[model samples]
Target chain A: MARAATTSDVFNAVAEPRRREILTLLVVGELEVGAIVTALRLDQPSVSKHLRVLRETGLVHMRRNGRHKLYRTNAPALQPVHEWVSTFERYWSNQLSRIKERAEAKMKQSRETGTSEKES
Target chain B: MARAATTSDVFNAVAEPRRREILTLLVVGELEVGAIVTALRLDQPSVSKHLRVLRETGLVHMRRNGRHKLYRTNAPALQPVHEWVSTFERYWSNQLSRIKERAEAKMKQSRETGTSEKES
Candidate 1:
């Protein structure tokens, strides 16, 4: 019998910053190996290795278009990750929202003070 | 100068399934070391090790409450992880939504067809 998929596999594959950057690049659109290599400024083999891990974890999809293999983000594989992170969103979201609100308030205050200062 | 925080450190710490589960448990409320270890059903040393990694990554906070150490999820530490994952959300989100739709549609279809045979 086949083993059930685990979240560890997905998280581990995505933990590498380089791999995350590659995924981000692919998010914009599909790209060939060369495009990714040039954009990331990483060794071709290293890029290939990260891609292999992502592909293995089902987080990425690749297709052969003539000679080059084009890679794209595989979204379904990422659902578990989102779900896992979302569990704590209720706890953290409020804090982030508050921080944002404070920053915006500060900016507004600064703008108002600037106008008054200029008038003075 | 201090080194900038790396996403790898955050992602790698969360990548461990046990550690993730611990975070989930802590999300509800603060818990002591004993409670976490018992809930996880792992060796004391193993739980300690996981907690150490979590604390080092800034993903968790601990305080001494009387005789025991209470642990809680540090929401700020997780923001970077969330941002990193959100980058690829657009690409994968649609695919997952489609799969969910298909699954729901199939279930609805089966319900509509009362004559359908049950699977073994």
Candidate 2:
């Protein structure tokens, strides 16, 4: 068994890329520490450290299953991060929508032209 | 002027709370380093350090305005973060709507009950 990490806030806890990888892995389902280590191909100590950080930050929930400790992401705990990032979403969403609309229009025009040529 | 920070990815750069605060302050408009210092109520060097990090990460754009350096957020750079967080949106969005629907139904039920009592 590994010692748990001291408390960390969401922002500080997720600073490392490895931690993010751990999160993406956990999003699908729960896994034991060894399973997580295998999934991420990380060493035991480093994975343990990141898990501790995520646990302390409330980003992940842990439970004891007899011998192994199972870990799973608590998605709602990321609301603050989601809210913060959302502030700037308006800037990109409009541009992306415009880009999508243009692509759709072009595709529709090409399809229409193709059909007309086929008929001719 | 302070030296710029080395390049950082969005996740790592935003890990610091002060940096997020600095980002919020810059979201509205550009500001000089001194103005940021005053806005955040942080010391000159700490503000400079964060600015450097943001600049290096490409999360912020720095321009020269006479003698002062102007800083503004590059919102599109956060697309990756936005996309990553959005993955979990489905979980919350549905849950929130269900909660709202329940609350609204309760209010409607109470109104109907009140009207019936009044008629009786």
lDDT of 2 by residue, B1-120 (tens): 221223557876776778888888887899999999998899999999888889888889999989999999888888888788888777567789988897777778778776432221
Candidate 1, CAPRI quality class derived from DockQ = acceptable
* Candidate 2 Cα misplacement greater than 4 A, ranges: A1-6, A95-120, B1-6, B103-120
For A1-120, candidate 1 gives per-residue lDDT tens digits of 221233238887777778888987887779999999999999999889788888888878999999999999786687788878877776778887988897777778778776433221
Q: CA shift at B56, candidate 2, in angstroms?
A: 0.9
Cα lDDT tens digits, model 2, A60-112, are 99999999999988888778888999999876677888788877777787786
Clashing pairs in 2: none
Candidate 1 at A13: error in angstroms? 0.4
> How many collisions between residues are there in candidate 1?
1
Give the residue spans of candidate 1 off by over 4 A: A1-8, A96-120, B1-8, B94-120
DockQ of 2: 0.35
